[model samples]
Target: MASVTLSGLRKEYGDLTAVDGLDLDVDDGELLCLLGPSGCGKSTTLRMLGGLETPTDGDVHIGDEPVTDQPPYERNTSMVFQSWALFPRKSVIENVAFGLKMDGVSEDERRERAREMLDVVEMGEFVDHDPTDLSGGQKQRVALARSLAIEPDVLLLDEPLSNLDKRLREQMQLELRNIHDAVETTFVHVTHDQNEAFTLADSIAIMHDGDIEQIGAPREVYDDPVSLFIEEFLGDTNLVDATVAEVTETGVIADTAFDTEVDVRTGDAAVAQGDGLSVSFRPEELDVERVEGTDGDGASAVTGEITDVLYRGSTVRFYVDLGGEHLFFEQSVGADTAFSAGDVVRVSWDPDDLLAFAADGARVGRGET
Candidate 1:
């Protein structure tokens, strides 16, 4: 296993800059993911790492060696594409052994290594079956076996499970993690699926428009996104517009519409009074209840009418109209406290769970809230 690094890596097509000065490091034997939407240069970055596409500038390194100018064969890495790219006429064993055959490994050793790799992927029984007869998930497994048969320094995967159905994709995500752990090889996977990235990656670099917006573990990036794009991209959040009401030693307080005051913990960044700030909170952190007569918690509670309720099997999501702006919150639905639409609820969350961001939606400080 070897670590992969890209420094100031770029790829341009005339006027269009596909990958722009991207820098990242994949730890030796760790599975890292390059996650983002389409056209975000994830695929280009992967191809550059695999030597399938040369960078316009910067360097690519595997282990301690600079391989920016190396051809695909010279680079000690294997790539699995989205389309599987297996030869339909080749049997499973042939498909897996193809790379070794090209490398001029003896036929006996090639078939033996192919069978061993297939066993690792739990597809040894289908070694003699035709590739056309296999299902989508089986084909992907075959592709994975083929990539692993070469025993490269790093494995690059480009949405290798996108062609499968949802269930199969989920299953493959687990299988891929197991394979990564078992092989102990550096893996760099690219995908737009949040669940896939969160589950499979030890570290994730979330890219946007040819640049990495945030790079962290799944929980770190999800909880403390650095920019507006990240906040909206990772998951659902209620971004409330508010102004800094006061700055205290502990934290800064913001007052929003409908006389709702929020306490935002300032981690390290200092903010002054009247600073334009936005308070961000996850729906799961909120508690919604029927508001009673006066004397409610001044800083915590916000009186709002539940405009709609969506019962998602595990949780219930509520859309509350607080004055003109709508806020969303979620509750763990249980047998008791079963709620429905048109419920006038007071929404409140733990002060420790509130995340405060700049007006531009960039997180200011780091804390529970």
Candidate 2:
């Protein structure tokens, strides 16, 4: 197993910069994901690391070896793509053996090694079947086996699960995680899908506008996002425009645009009174009930009318209109009574769960609210 390092990595096309000054370290045997929306440079970064695309500036290293000038094969890195990239005219075994054969392995050794890799991906039974005859999942497994057959120091995946149906993709996600655990090979994956990145990677490196935004473990990134873009992109969250009214011992009190003052848990830093802030919280953290009195069971409460009710699986989502501003709150089945559209209710949440950021939207939490 080997680690990967990128120093001052950049890619440009005339005036268009696809990747800009990226500095990242993918730990040995750790699966790292480059995640972002379209044109955010995750794929471009992956291509540079795989040696498929040349970086305009920077150095790439695999373990202790500097591979900045090496070709794809010469860098000991194998890439799996969303297209599967399997051979239509070849059998599953043949497709898996192609890389080994190209590497000048003996005919007998290539076949044996390919079969072993196929078994690792649970496609051993499909070895003799034509790749054209297999389903999307089977084809992807063959593609993965093909990459592993070469025993490369690093494996790169570019949106490899994006083409599959929802159910199949979820199933493959678990299978892929299990496979990575078994291989102990360093992997760098690029994808725009948040769920895919969260489930597959040991840590996620978020990219935006050709730059690295935030890189951390899944929970750390999701729970304490470094910016407004991160909070909105990684999950469903609410951001209320507000101004700090007072800085308390535990957190800070913010006065929202709705004319309500809320106590927000200081995340990474503290802000003083009069500072502009954006208060954030997940919909599931909200507590909603009929407004019978001023008391909200100690949580900050807001009066609103339900404008919509959405039923999704065991959870029901309620969209509320609070004086022309819309906010969403959700509850699981049997955890609380469901609300109907047009119902007058009060939405409240724990102050400690509320997070506030600077007006610029950068993360400022560390209990600083």
Candidate 3:
């Protein structure tokens, strides 16, 4: 296993910059996931690490050696692509052994290593199956086996499970985590799927544009997002626009679009009256109760009429119309309260749970009491 590092990494195409000056470090035997939406330079960053793309500026290091100038084959890394680029003409084991064969290993040794990798990936029984006949999940396993057959120091995975069905992809996420544990190879996985990153990564680096926005364990980043982009990208939540009405010793009072003035616990956040703020109300943090009249009493509670009710597999989502603005909350389907459209309800939450962001997309307060 080897620790990987990137310093001042950059890549540009004519006038378009895919990767800006970015620096990152991957610990030995750690699984780090680069997570972001499309065109965020995550794949470009991964390619640079694997020596598949040369950085326009900056350096790449593996372990203690600088490898910016090294070619793909010269680096001790293997990449599993989204396409599962298997050889249609070769058997499963032959495909797995192909990399070793190219590296000048003897036929007997390469085949033995291939069998061992196949077993590690739980594909030992399909050594002789044709690649064309394999299912999507089976193909992905074979591709993984092929990459692992060479015993690379750092394994690069570029959306390797994106092609599988939802259930199969989820299953593969767990299996991949197990495989990483068994092999202990340094892994750098790139994906835009939030759940996948949460499942497989020892740490997640959220990318925006060409640089990393935030990096931490799954729950750490999710629970304490540093910016509005990070908060919005991590999951679904109700973002309401508001303006500061007054600043007090305890917190700030903000007039929200929900036709109510709410108290936000802004921990040492610099703000003044009339400043615009985007307040996040996460669905799970909200408490909802069916009400008859529009009058709701409390600084943290507001009365709204249910506009729509969506029945998800295990949870129900409700959209509420407060004045002219909309906010939503969710509840498990087995919950006792059964709300429908046109039902007036009171939506309330703790002031500390609200995360406020300024106009510049920076989080206003730490939300600490």
Candidate 4:
């Protein structure tokens, strides 16, 4: 296992800058994921690390060695691509043995290593089968076996699970993380899937438009997204424009966009009076309950008619129209949620779940999302 370092990494295509002066250090044996939407330079960054694309400016080092100018073959790194690039005519064992064969290993040793790698990926029974005969998931395992057969110092995965079905892709995510833990190789994975990064990475580097927006643990980045872009990109959130009314010892009080006052947790952020704020919270953080007798407990933060109820198998999504402002709320699967469109309901939420961000999208002391 080896640590990878990138400094001032840059890639340009004519007038467009794909990667703009990026600096990142991935620790040894850590599974680091470069996560972002398409056109965010995640794949480009991965290509540069794999030596497939030369950077316009900057350096890449694997451990103590400078490998900026080296070709892919000399970098001692293995890549598993989205297409599972296995030779159609080659058998499973043969494809896995190809890397070892290129490195000048004996035929017997190469086959032995190939079998071991196939077993590691749980594809040992398909050793004699051609790549064309394997299913999508099986082909993926073969590709992983081939990459692991080389005993690479670093393993680079470029959305290797993108081709699989939803269930199979989720299964592979766990298996891939387990494999990384067993081998302890420094793995750098690039994907636009936020859940993939949250599930597999030791640290996530959120990329946006050729730059890193925020990089941290999945929970940390999810809980305290620094800006509106980060808040919306990482996950689904309800964003409301509010004005900072008061900064209290526990949190901050704000006048919500819908003409309601609410207190929100301040995560060490500074807020000033009359500051335009954007409040963000996940759908799960807010709940809808039956509007029983008395209007006590400040239960009615906002009253709205149910505009829609989307049953999503494991959970149901309720869209409420609070006057002109609309927001969605989610709840776990239940047959007792006798809610439908046009039902009057009261929505309530814990103030601690709210995050505040400035109008310009910058984080104020504990405000802004």
Per-model C-alpha lDDT, please?
0.87, 0.86, 0.93, 0.87
lDDT of 2 by residue, 1-369 (tens): 799999999999999999999999999999998999999988888988899999999999999999988988777899999899898898889999998898999999999999999889988899899899888888899999999899889999999899999999999989989989999999898889999999998999999999989999998888777888898899888888888888777677788877777777784355777999887767978877887544543328788788998888878888888677778977887664768887888888878777667888786674343
Residue-wise lDDT of candidate 4 within 1-369, one digit each (tens)?
899999999999999999999999999999999999999999999999999999999999999999999999999999999999999888899999999999999999999999999999999899999899899999999999999899999999999999999899999999999999999899999988999899999999999889888888888888777778888888887888888788777667888876677887664476677888888857878877766432533512677788999998898888888667787888777758778888877888877777777888876654332
- What is candidate 3's TM-score against the reference? 0.97
lDDT of 4: 0.87
Clashes of 3: 0
For 79-197, candidate 1 gives per-residue lDDT tens digits of 99999999998999999999999999999999999999999988989999999989889999999999999999999999998899988899999999999999999999999988899
Which of the predicted structures, 1 or 3, would earn the higher TM-score when compared with the native? 3
Locate the minimum summed-lDDT window of 10 residues in model 3. 360-369
Candidate 1 versus truth, CA RMSD in Å, comes to: 1.9
Residue pairs with clashing backbones, model 3 = none
Residue-wise lDDT of candidate 3 within 1-369, one digit each (tens)? 899999999999899899999999999999999999999999999999999999999999999999999999999899999999999999999999998998999999998999999998889999999999999999999999999988899999999999999999999999999999999999999999999999999999999999999998999999889899999999999999999999987678999887689999886679999999999999989999988896784689988899999999999999999878988999889888989999999999998899899999998876465
Clashes of each: 4, 11, 0, 9
My TM-score estimates for the predictions, one after another, are: 0.94, 0.94, 0.97, 0.93
Candidate 4: regions farther than 4 A off: 245-252, 267-271, 292-300, 366-369
Candidate that beats the other on TM-score, 3 or 4, i.e. the better one: 3
